[model samples]
Target: MIKIISCILLVFASTYSFACKDPLYKDKYQITNFSGYSDVIVARIITSKHNDDEMYSPLMSFDAAVLEKIKGALTPNQVIHVSAKIEDPRAACPLYFKENSTYLLLLERQEGELQISRFSFPIESNNEHFSSYLSQVKSGINIH
Candidate 1:
């Protein structure tokens, strides 16, 4: 009975830990579009599982609104660094992708191209930490 209770508690703790911190979590992923949409950068995550495919499937999309704001405060063509907490679509599926369940992104526009310079994740789940990290990333960039 004690063992059963301990296992139940463990499962509950793990589940609570896995919940996302920010409802508006955003991730930075590299994307190159020649459509003059560089001013409006978008983030699309491609699963590692689909590496062999020519096209990258977008897990989600986020407008670089925070990055835009940062740019507005800085010089033209200035690089803006920001982080967004990304959701794992595979978390719900038998369709798991890679081992790391979350990712962070750093993005900028250079020479009419939107570039994602960084993508990584934390060791554990923390929604507040994720949101704060993204906010810090947004604040670091000179969006103007």
Candidate 2:
């Protein structure tokens, strides 16, 4: 009887699913840590398009003009390309890059190219909150 009850409880527990909460907000220390972890730049999206090719389907790419190099060695006005996954309804954090919008991007360099993800530290270029974080980066604060 004890073994049968334990098996039934285990079966029910295995079938149960839990919903995950979205973690969209980054705290000050986390934002500051991104400056040290990835190449940080202020850039304007020159163009963006969804990849429709079957080989690269489900991806979106953006061509951006680097407005300023906050932490990285990127040259001002240089055109850089970045890519991310399309907005997934099942994803907790869906990142979308809009054309003509400016952003302060934390980019991860991969195989000689830059990429951004929903987990990447991306903030609007005009957001006032960024000033405080940028100041810390500029001051060479210890990110760890």
Candidate 3:
């Protein structure tokens, strides 16, 4: 029992220790052509799985359901896959989405698949910061 508890603690500590405390980019670009940049959606992360087998490096896979389509042709309730590297918070660009949480995501298309944009990070749907972006997306205002 003691060993199991210790192992759990260690794993928890390791994951938290990798959390990034700062945004990858501080500037927000006015999204002139929304579709040209990426597809914007309000989605809930259904599951997040960690995989380190692709490149022998840690990465997270997020399977999400599109709750609302702010822009682009994505159908609501559609599932999408997104991946992000597991690295120190300061060095990682792709924002990690928590399982079961809804987020305003700006997704770019890569190799025929939708992906987290190389621009800004994901914002929780209920977060104060999400409204501004949501409004911008709805209004067709350039801002990601």
Query: What are the per-residue Cα lDDT tens digits for candidate 2 across 2-105?
Result: 99999999888765532223444443624535543456777899888765663323336789999888666689989988877334434343455678888777
Worst 10 residues of 2 by lDDT: 17-26
Off by over 4 Å in 1: 23-59, 62-107, 110-112, 115-144
**Selected candidate, larger lDDT, 1 vs 3:** 3
Tell me which residue pairs clash in candidate 3.
Answer: 20-89, 30-142, 31-142, 31-143
Candidate 1: worst-modelled 10 consecutive residues by lDDT:
116-125
Task: Encode model 1's per-residue lDDT on 1-144: one tens digit a residue.
Answer: 999999999999998765534233346312222232223322222333322342233222222222222222233333433322233434321112232333343334555344432122321123446555544544544332
lDDT of 2 at 55: 31
Model 3 lDDT per residue over 1-144, tens place? 999999999999998876645453223424535656467888999987755554323336689999997777788989888765334445444445678999877777767776554244667877665777677667674434
Predicted structure 2: lDDT: 0.65
Q: Compare the candidates by lDDT and give the number of the best one.
A: 3
Q: What is the C-alpha RMSD of each candidate to the true structure, in Å?
A: 12.8, 6.8, 8.7
The residue ranges of model 3 lying beyond 4 angstroms of the native Cα positions read 1-21, 24-36, 51-59, 85-94, 141-144
Query: TM-score of the candidate numbered 3?
Result: 0.62
- Write down the worst ten-residue block by lDDT for model 3: 24-33
lDDT of each: 0.35, 0.65, 0.67
